[model samples]
Target: MSDHPILFLPGPTEVDAELREIMARPLIGHRSAGFVDDVQQVCQRLKWLYQTSQHAVFESAPATALMEAAFRNLVRPGGRTLHLVCGAFSERWSKIATDCGRKPELLTVPWGMAHDAASLRQKLASSPTFEAVCITHNETSTGVIEPLQELAAVVRDASPSTLILADVVTSLAGAPLNFDAFGLDLAFAGTQKCLALPPGIATYALSHRALERARSIEGRGYLLDFVRAVPETEAGKTLATPCVPLLWALRAQLDRIATEGLARRFARHIAMQHETLAFMHQWQIEPFVADSAARSPTISCLKASGRDVRQLAENATKAGYKIDQGYGDLKGKTFRIGHMGDHTVARLQKMLAALLR
Candidate 1:
């Protein structure tokens, strides 16, 4: 048995044995011809998953780094940014914008609730034009998935030129996202979540319009510069040395994803969500996101239903599983079960049974 508890957390999900073995291979220099070819191939394959024509770039950082990159590259210093906040991660984006010296205008909804397109339409009609509107496709903290396609349309109708930047950290591989079809200027995700890889790497793709916006903007620092990185990525290169091992693991996993079929993968996630929901029902617990349509298929936040969620988490730990007690203010009142990544219904059922036991 492995020493570390199996991860059932929202991120840094279990890297399967195949990927682990792939990572064990000797590392290659990021600048090598072979590595460049691998990057190019992986980027092309990634387009299949993103369902977009735009090529994706791999960065040796967490998804939050790319969140900051979106601001620095797309928005001018202190530019007006409209943040749609419904949960912790969305709120974090607003805080990051503030930390970057931008006075972000937030359209907040209750936690565990989703931002509706109608409210966004009203807000955009009344407010001044924003440089960009930040949106979280899936709120990992609350297990709420925003209606991004609808919101994107509302943005185009109300504020045509305003860039739509999305954080798909928990939705990328497991959810259906058509970047080009939805008219998203930029969409990004970390590998740890639904991609099922270990933490420390992120991938992102942006539209040509966003690239033009980045070129027009200044103060778009060195490391995360979209103008510098996008072109290089198109040519199978990166601005800096990437996490080579993770890149290898990503390539293997992308291949696995292709073999499994993207539609099949999505169906698998939905099945897992149903299985988890059924288990929660049996326990007489309810999901924190009351509206089923708004709930994330990747992570399920269930109310503790008067149970000690902290102790429940500890019990899972003792049983050689790692589970979330819940996040922030909801700590004892709710608990989370991450059903994304490489996890399947059967495996999740086993874990659910173990937790209940």
Candidate 2:
């Protein structure tokens, strides 16, 4: 590897050695038999990652597109949608719903605070029946991971008919998420984050309820229609030209994850978070998210009360170590360290040593 600072940002984390080789492989036509075969294998691996027995649509577009797709499919024009927001990415899905003409309401908490199940239950009780409830499993901006499983239960008990949609962009393989067991109607993720691959393709899954709801919607655009996409995806081919190179890379990366074992990988992320927290304690750097249990194992955010967060991040980048300043409204108020996607405790120690200096 070159002397370039290793990436410690939330996404595009790192490409493993095997994936590098696989991405260099000769290209294949999107509709060719060879491409279909590759995708079939990738989808199988993706289903395992998604923790769903049902097939998933691995779209060529970014994760944001899938957000709109979910809105178009589940919430018909002018239908009510509830968006639970705690950070930038979660808020974006709400915007997507708004643009799609699906009336979306935000059930929001402060940046560092995690949304609790009791609050959600109260909201569901007071609000009119909604077509869908959108949630972000891990708030990448604030480095907070919502208690998704518990929230799902709350949604089911409150409103069984409402579809539960989640964005697991940063939590997919890095955490212990069970889609089927969680009873989530729909969930999606991009390969760029914890999956440790370059940006391009995105993955999404739908439960029986979600699929039925999607079919009932009308006039969804060709590309954004989940009802139209299922047939093509079931055959391991996208609705249009797919990203062949990224698909190949995803296949290789899935093998890497499988070899490491999901449980071990999740433990590795938690252990690395613990290591970072230990360093924070020694440095007297406070965490932005006060609740220890609410913090994300994939990313750690530090308050910047006594430090120049941007300067520190810039210095690290100049010194060949990549880190991130806070995102959106929290910019300059906090700094983030991404501990997901192949970042080991030893690697983090070295990166932290460079930054702490």
Report lDDT (CA) for all predictions: 0.89, 0.88
Which candidate number would show the highest lDDT if scored against the true structure?
Answer: 1
The lowest-lDDT stretch of 10 consecutive residues in candidate 2 is: 1-10
TM-score of 2: 0.97
lDDT comparing candidate 2 with the true structure: 0.88
TM-scores of all candidate predictions against the true structure? 0.97, 0.97
The deviation in Å at residue 276 for candidate 1 is 0.9
Model 1 residue runs over 4 Å out of place are 1-3
